[model samples]
Target: MNQPHPSEHYPVIIVGGGQAGLSMSYQLQKRDIRHIVFEKNRIGHSWRADRWDSFCLVTPNWQCRLPDFPYQGDDPKGFMLKDEIVEYIEAFARKVDAPIKQGVAVTRVRRGKQDRLEIRTSDGDYTADHVVVATGGYDIPIVPDYAHSLPQRIAQVHSMHYRNPGQLPPGEVLVVGSGQSGVQIMEDLHLAGRKVHLAVGSAPRSPRLYRGRETTEWLYDLGFYDLTVDRHPLGDEARHKTNHYLTGRNGGHEIDLRRFALEGVKLYGSMAGIQGARLEFKPDLRKNLDEADEVYARIRADIDKYIAANRIGAPEEAPFRKVWEPESEPLSVDADEAGITAIVWAIGFRPDYRWIELPVFDGRGHPQFRRGVTDAPGLYFVGLPWLNTWGSGRFLGIAEDTEYLAATIAERSASQRAAA
Candidate 1:
């Protein structure tokens, strides 16, 4: 290990080495801006470590556009699995020569003593005219507090730690939280011949393909991704909503809870708690499923209208039919009674910004930034959820958002030099 240095300064500093951070570095590098990116681990480490072996990007390959190297593979419409994503990111770093200091973890980002922003890292302290928190959104998997109440006999795990079925115990799996991760993992376990039960939450479900086109293409063509927070009716709710229930495995298909129920996977309401060895839940399964179906219906209606008004012909698609329901109100079951030997928390993730010792965060600990610009001077944010548009947190959206932040940083630098 190298000795720690003190007071080294730069024009800009970016935290994280994921796609967001690399994109910001590329943008700054293009303009000859002196900036450094500090990653707690190696580049693409999060995607490599946090994701399961079967994990693939929900977004299509073509939509993963970086600054210089856009995805131009043979399968533009296909999804890239974990390995491919890491390879693409590594190639981007090599191509751009992004000045990323790997293994340097940022401990604190606060206002410096003078005019610059201060950053304390494992390597050393750094001051910069601008700091881009490009850490991206999925930082930590959010397991509920009540999960600790589960019996010691029942092994518990989060989706982030789950690699395969063999890794779990020798009985049924209880998957909590019905978002993207929950459904995907449940399906993986079910196909592996392990009986699985899922606690369906309120997160909406989306079809992999809407009409003849991929759901992404339909939404992209409809300008849904370009919709800003100001334009959305749900506003912050729309911006901060958990990921919809969808899958990118085996060429993508809908992960309908009702379908899962039909396929022998037990369905229950939102997980309430664990009373000793028993797992408690509500009976809102039908209500929750309806809400998800409603959203899907609205989205399809909009797409149909667009095709009709534009005189564009599209194939008539069959509407999703829900024919299966739980026989009666789901009863609280003892862990062993349900044959559940392991419980997996697929409750999604929340961004970790604990290192930022600043007052710029909201009550929820999200940054107080508008379109990537913060209230504090020289303090900027990029790739945060809905910083500009619906896709702001995505790979393609991060690239676009970072470019804007870089331009803003440059303008501020030029003004400061002029004032000096």
Candidate 2:
């Protein structure tokens, strides 16, 4: 009665409660494997926490699929908002009866005695034969170094903390990084009557719908996501590529930065550096705009070629608008002169795996893994960009990757049992 029972160990421990973790848990549960998912916050906390109130799925509703669940709404093509995404994940966890330990944030994951993995969490210590870091590689916000150079009087917030226009200070807003987040927030704030200045950067604008079909349809048919990371033409750039510019506002549409500039959102080229109260920018506004248009044309050309080759019947082509219209004066403007009082860093995120005491990262600090399997025999990572394919980091690809990892875990566990 005086001696306490030993802590029971599980075969696998998953370190996130997002879609990736839940998807993996569903597959493992189906295989009757023993595993536990430890989440820092509640299930789907990432979506519930960081995303703006108006944020919706960049992909269509039908693509939001889990193992045992899928988008079942009447509007299959409609986008799901942030709250709906959280609800879907919560429902998925319940449906699979996922063994999730909510509010248990894993502080460390390192090799323990006998090579078993020890995961230290806020709740308690847990050991597992295999550990899966399903923490979808985008937790750490990536703000530019020059952000600190701005006067401390100006407020700065990353996209993760940004919610609505109301949350921002009542003044001109400067949105850095011209990717999806930057463009969307800039548009929303501008429509809300706030003066927004968007710092132009490397971003590819894609049409929301093309030839009466979702652009996603053409991508799926073209097998764009089927290309493996190792074989992608972008080479190492494949891992750190920025998201293409598109917005779900107004039921999804092309987000044109050039048009935004004409519509009063003062556009500046890539931010060079900060000098006292003046912010300097690289004079590449036209260059960046042309590059984005090139990408758009490439996409359209590819789709049209596919349509012609397949003899696919499609609706009449929608009139394409010019991506740019020259302003009477140079589009470049000074942040301080624009009366900017707030700077929101929409620059993307990087993965924070410092807690993982393992030598399995690439030169870029990304995990070294083929698909989800790491070289560390018992350690694995999931839901990372290009882990297997272009889609590996997305909802449609998570289930596929999870299925493979789950099977691998089950097969390896069986072999271990036999040897024992």
Candidate 3:
């Protein structure tokens, strides 16, 4: 295959070589469309850079499969470790023969005159009729303002920078979030012989699995995981709240903080603010989790009713039972004595579009797209949270979104050629 010169124009240009980008490339290749991908780093940077050494996908191998490539492994329900996912991505890229310019960081994507899209990267400039931003949303880790006031002796790390339990000092560790990342890290530190304290935050009650199969499979069957932001109104609501879809397929494996507490992990209310060498917390997280659980139950019931009405085979039902709830007590701990020599902010991430000079961004810094099409013709965005539905932005859920965006670009390209 001949590489296009820097001055040459391609039909399509994709930004970010992660799962979403690679997926789009594969689909375009099948259609015999000429496209080039610009990746800031090597493929699977999330699996390589952000994940811990022992990290594995919360979703099993079966559900983690991409569009054309299924995970060919003995353990379908088994978690794919970080390195394993990276290797899978490499193999996928090789199989598709994707035209990727590795080590080229996209500095900006802007609209050129005459409907041409300009992609400026560190290496050189590239022009295309259409540009797809498949960059996932977890790029920027959001650390709160209170972190700066902490004493110099304490170490602070975001979930993005956390690698292993060995990186922290030997003392009680305070994890300042109850999300999946926070719960997983707390469990890891506790098992590694460190005392663990988890600061509870507003979180949805999600099971590790659902019914007899993985939660993702159940969601797929019911078409729950197939929703896009453009198709589902509830998607926007789900994105605003921390309530996540949890399933009951982990067997006896429970990784929630309550399970850790049974294994000696101390739980606290949400962290309020930082004091001198001390952290203050409010004890209302349990109430919040409980309230969130009730809301989830209602939603689940509605889903079940919909499935039954549509004659969808009933998924194995996992009974929900309230286990651990937060208490109403203000908790405080000395930063030095808590053995929490470090703080890992597993709070969340936000999209950063400073380099993107397009006018599609809304006040919240998210691109304004209608089902992946931007106001600017020939510009599109994929892999955004709540892009069109509940699952539009997830790893296993981007195939539909990519397909829609690709079709739109192809149609537009055809129209332009006809006009020309």
Candidate 4:
């Protein structure tokens, strides 16, 4: 192992150079604060590496608002593709002129001597009066243990590594989970004419358009984007909930698993276990579908009420009708019988903060904080899902969260200078 050089010092050190970290840097620059951002890879690494080729933002481009930068494109209502999204973030990074060190991975962060925080990175050692952890929650791809039970012929890839249908062997593909990524990847495969099977989870559905307007616009008008975790009915539980599944591909539209079923895509309940050559699934296919539809209907109802209350002029549309229903749920599927050659695990990712040696974490390893301000002095967090509001981790609400943390950090720095 290479020895770390003499520790360098900075007034503030930020870990992770994604959207959240970049936004925080922009705020600090506006306040003339001295800070350095450390990124494990180049800027917009996640967007350029993790997402599939057909990926696009589910939200409109108009919501792509950084601190002082907003989407200046003409098609604000249109969703930006994966490449475009990367360019947008890259542009912001250039505009901010952030003092960022790319390809420097922070391996550990712990309390150091003299009441400062020590940051251990691949490059060298450093200490800062204040530290901000901007690493987002999606750090590690999660795969079930049962996946190892499959035969060697069965190829498996996590959603993060999955690029396209051609990346897999030429055979039927099994997609696990019905979250945003799972459903979208399934559609990507189906559109490519691959024989696909899906294990539907309990992720809710979101409407793309209602009353001739984008549903997101309506929701924003209703102040849904401004709803904070504390004020939400489900409280913090809302943070753990899976995001509603929808698609921004080929313009925006709703994703109906029932319609997928109607088009001959095999659908199953939540994956339970794997036995020999058969994959077992819980008999909850019908239940999961029904519940998803219930949420779909509820959202439309809310929009209808909003339209009526505001006396808005909109065309009346027909109520939603079930296009298809499962006659019987299959408990298990024989992998060989179905000619399944590959599996895409889109279940989701787990947060890995093992490097953080501080005691400011919860039982589940989640950081304990009130809108990025932790109980530990000089320790802060940003870019977490639902850190303050529904848009906390998204492009829509990151500016507000980062600005708040910057102000808090600046005030604390001023107070410390006075004391010294």
lDDT of 1 by residue, 1-420 (tens): 123555889999999888888899989988889999998899989789988889998888988888878995788888899999999988888887788899999998888677778888998888988899877777788888887777788899989899999998898999998888888899899999999988988999777787688888888989988999878888766657877778879878877788778889998889888887899888888888889888878878888898898888788988767778667767588887778899999887887889887788888877777788988898888877788898888877877888899899889899999999
Candidate 4 Cα outliers beyond 4 Å, as residue runs: 1-6
Kindly give the stretch of ten consecutive residues in candidate 4 with the minimal lDDT sum.
Answer: 1-10
List the lowest-lDDT window of 10 residues for candidate 1.
Answer: 1-10
Worst 10 residues of 3 by lDDT: 245-254
The TM-score values for the models, in the order shown, are: 0.96, 0.94, 0.89, 0.98
How many backbone clashes does every candidate have? 0, 0, 15, 0
Supply the global lDDT for candidate 1: 0.85
Instruction: Write down the lDDT of every candidate, Cα atoms only.
Output: 0.85, 0.83, 0.75, 0.92
lDDT of 4 by residue, 240-282 (tens): 8999999999888999998999898999999998876788999
Regarding lDDT, does 2 or 3 come out ahead? Answer: 2
Best-to-worst order by TM-score is 4, 1, 2, 3
- Cα lDDT tens digits, model 3, 15-75, are 9898889889988877778999988888888789888776777766777657778887788
lDDT of 2 by residue, 1-420 (tens): 112544458999999988888888988988998899998888777889888989998888888778768886788888888888888888888897788888889998888777788777887787899999998878789887867777877788999999999997788998888898888889889999998877788888887888989998798899987888889988657878877889877687888777787788887787777765677778777777878888887888889999999999987675566756545334345556778889888888888889998889877788888878999988988888888998888888988899999999999999998998
Better of 1 and 2 by TM-score: 1
Model 3 clash tally? 15
